[model samples]
Target: MFLGSGSFISTTKAPSKEVAKPAVTAKRLMFLDSSITDSSVEVLQLPSPASLRKCALYAVFDGKVYWLRGIKPNINPVSLFVGNSIVNEDHFLATFKFDVIFIFTSLLFLKHDKFISVPQRIYELYRSGVVDSEECSVLESGMLALWNHNVDKVQDRLEYLCQKIKSDGSKDPLLKPNIDSFRAMLEHKVQSLEKAVQKSNLMMGSYCRASETSCHNHVRKNYIDFREGKLRLFCWSVISQMLNPEARSHLVPAKCDFNDISSHLQSTSSTAPLITSGNKGAKQRKITVAKGTPSILGFFKRT
Candidate 1:
């Protein structure tokens, strides 16, 4: 989310500013997502606290506010004021420890969301009466995976939104990190996520059944039905495509959603001793193999 103009937000309308008359109030608008484009850059006529709440991450460029909404329900804000190159995820953590950044000495703001994230959804699940407290505890990781994804990758996504708002003088590529650094950072984070994915599964079975994935009734009620299952968890090749759109090779997951518990199951079985079809003929048969499943499945069973 890039706040294109660098002017302070005013409650009253500024004739010089472009004010958007959103049909819905800013409070209703959730998700400052990866889908940012020049068109989606909006300046609300009257943005309330709730509209500002839509952004999980924010950047101030030139003087206007820009932002990106993340899937996580609770997020502490990290403000990127002018005169910063990049805040590496590692640096974001260390700042809190050492207080090396001068801005930390002063007040910046952040908050928690009561709606529109995994924790909030599970809260509704218990309220829905479809699942018990115990069941909600083992809720699918796909949504959780969305929240737990690498913070740096989310930060890098900020660069594109910033591009949409830059003036001619601000068009320097160095305003963000070089593309190679972006590529390397994305690649490293991706491998780390995949290794974690290979080891994580907390759903009841080997794969999620869409019926059992989320509290469907709760989801439909919240969505304007546009974005319920549409969020990408963390298949990095998708980010890779975003970074280098012209690249010929595609690295997308075939059936994987980066969540081991995705409803689409991976094919892991082989023909079991090829059954006889006719005389001197044999045919292949498919069988489920539960052996390669993550050991954490046992913990769910014990529950």
Candidate 2:
């Protein structure tokens, strides 16, 4: 077969056993760019192959080599390439941005089609009390931050979600398996999303930590006491909602009451704004000051 400087072997490292078959040449195979054509197109050469059976299908794009390995037996081939130079931080971050956009677009579409009630699923779950308090709070805060386009709050909520999921799984026996399964699913989605974007050096830090913890638990569970009081997760309840006698035990009084100090300050200085208790624990005061007095709120450290 006629060929150019692109006729090369597979980059995959095959076994040492020599297969009694003619070596597959680059011409026999085809590089099909699904986005461009229904049939194969002329593309760059493959890598140097070590053997035939172990030879993997690969493609060179830009300056890097993409190694395509078939995971499942025969049904369909799924590429499991992760880390390395393919999926980097920028790639997954772009993916996260795209996901955020896609979510909003879908919500908009639903809104346009009179499917607005569907978005209230979280609220329904919240009302039913099926969702835990902390989870509901996180979701509510996250959605509010998202609506306000507050990226920092959104990131904080996402980080908290990761921590909560890990903490819940480790502390609760029934939830451990489910959490492990959920984390595994996330890892798959993360890799697939990264691959779709065609970026390398992707970091699996979020889910990897959870997976490592799971593995560590699996090893340690057999050796250590599971019912140790120190290992139990502290009950999560709204600090303001600690009025119930049963739940009051979990509430630990702070070393010094910020409310008391604020009250004292307000009484001492008439110019100082009145500190009013708001919904939840956040406190905000509007104080009249000489034009641009550098925010009175900055004068007092938020406790």
Each candidate: RMSD: 22.6, 26.4
What's the C-alpha lDDT at position 277 in model 1? 24
Q: Which candidate is the best by TM-score?
A: 1
| TM-scores for the candidates | 0.24, 0.18
Please provide, for model 1 over 216-277, each residue's C-alpha lDDT reduced to its tens digit, 9 standing for 90 to 100: 55651211111112222333422332221112122233355332433332344223222212
Model 2 regions lying over 4 Å from their true place: 1-98, 105-125, 150-303
**Which numbered prediction scores highest in lDDT against the true structure?**
1
lDDT of 2 by residue, 181-267 (tens): 323433444446445423443222111111111225345221111211111111111121212221122222333232244343334
TM-score of 2: 0.18
Superposed Cα deviation of residue 99, candidate 1 (Å): 22
